[model samples]
Target: MAQATPAKPFLLPAAIAATLVLCGLIAWMIESRAVILREGTEIVLQSEPIDPRDLLRGRYVVLGYPSQRIGGPLLDPLRAEIGEGETIDDATVYVTLRQGPDGYHEPVAVSLAEPDEGLFIRARATRVAHDMTWLFLDFGIGRFYTNEHRAPELERRMREGALTEIVVAVAPDGTAQIKALRQAGETIITEPLY
Candidate 1:
């Protein structure tokens, strides 16, 4: 009878390759956020608290920004891009922000093309109004995870009008990550770069 070749050798190499791939993927994710935290421009945004519950992901605070909706001058560029009888939805847009006297960054302009200068956050248009006069945008920085014990207290303070805000780091390309949470201009929790 012919000798059977062993499967152990192939199994060992496959398992090793799989583990290496996983490690590389995890490292890439961590480094991407770290780059933003380390070198990006910092901006503070006024936040509104929403629900704080997730059975699978644990407790986290959901944040809403007044700047989420854009209209008037801010929508002009986007409006000009839409052709007659054409609808725009789920398109990438860059929003230039100017800091108000209150130290909160507000949307100053929105463009289908990335701004050559100015601090802007990249967002995807969730939907364009029928009149093409407004765009609802998602910045993708709306969630802040916290420990179970702290989640409730933070939400309560926000609900009771404690003036909560989020400190975000925005990369040159407009990618952003939450760097810290603030209450009345005081830093509450700082995210680790890892």
Candidate 2:
């Protein structure tokens, strides 16, 4: 059998260029997120407990919001606009939010189209079940990182029913970033946009 030819000499340079491009793209993405967090419209959202776990997230508490699940009377109005025989699962939904007197924003409506105005967030439905009666959506701002020692205290307070809120920054395009974590109206952690 004939011996296989050696790899092309230009292969190494091509590989290096590809790697550099990939790194640049990643840096740009991170910078964009930081910009949104730094200058976007700020809003506080009420949060509920998410299971605490040790993983790659590094001693953080996962958080869930009631707005993540838009159901009950909320589903009725959307059904008419969404029509029938359409799959909402894994679909991108624009959720309109209205700020309350307490400075916490609440979901007011869900739509297939992005709204022209008003405060809103773009989330993907992880699951849509029971004929649209339930929607499990993720806004990609669900985790709050902290030191190992502080996590337990926060978790304990969460267990004791202490108030926890997620301060989010929403950009004009409906992209959102978790800006800080607040417990009992006190900011415990603020994320740096790096």
Candidate 3:
């Protein structure tokens, strides 16, 4: 007698689709909480949000004028040279000569080429279907809280029309920090995680 032929098992396409969907969901969740960490020296700095594309090594935000916290003469002659077309060198650029007792970020030495500043800055970038926009603020990483819920406090200050000042922290290597805003009589770097 002839032996009976074995039949092939059927595959379920629906189960495969479900597995793919689950994987996509997990990837999206993890990406939502990803943080980009940029660090510098121990100093508290404030930033004004702008387009992220506007920032780079050769091109940077000005410490004084337009939106200035420290009102005084240009501490460094180089400040005048940082126009739209001008290219900053690898050396440090000093904007403010001295810092107030409150220890706000005053302009000391600003270098257009490197992370010469003592404060680490932070921002958020979002991508659309065909374009990308970034929330560029001059504020340092110290300003942002790990828990985003506290962001209201930052908004409240802006709403209340609080007065702000700029100060500087000078490092031995000639790195200068330009802090745009800070609390009165408050110092930022008593302790830092980095």
Count clashing residue pairs per candidate: 0, 0, 15
Candidate that would win on lDDT: 1
lDDT values for all models:
0.88, 0.85, 0.35
Residues 26-107 of candidate 3 have per-residue lDDT tens digits of 8765443221111223343333432111222322223322222322343133335454334332223333233335444444
Please tell me which model should have the higher TM-score, number 1 or number 2.
Answer: 1
Order by TM-score, highest first = 1, 2, 3
Give candidate 2 regions above 4 Å deviation: 1-16
lDDT tens per residue, model 2, 1-194: 89999879999999999999999999999999999999999989988876567677678878888889888777776787778867678888889999988878988888878999999999998998867778889998887788888888878777776847889999998999889888878987788887
For 30-98, candidate 1 gives per-residue lDDT tens digits of: 999999999999999988889758888899988888888898877766667766767768888899999
Q: Where is model 3 more than 4 Å wrong at Cα?
A: 1-76, 79-86, 89-96, 100-145, 163-170, 174-182, 186-191
lDDT (0-100) at residue 152 of candidate 1? 89
Q: Could you list the CA RMSD of all candidates, in the order they appear?
A: 1.7, 3.3, 12.8
Which candidate do you rate higher for lDDT, 1 or 2? 1
Candidate 1 to truth, TM: 0.92
Error of 2 at 155 (Å): 1.3
User: What residue pairs clash in candidate 2, if any at all?
Assistant: none
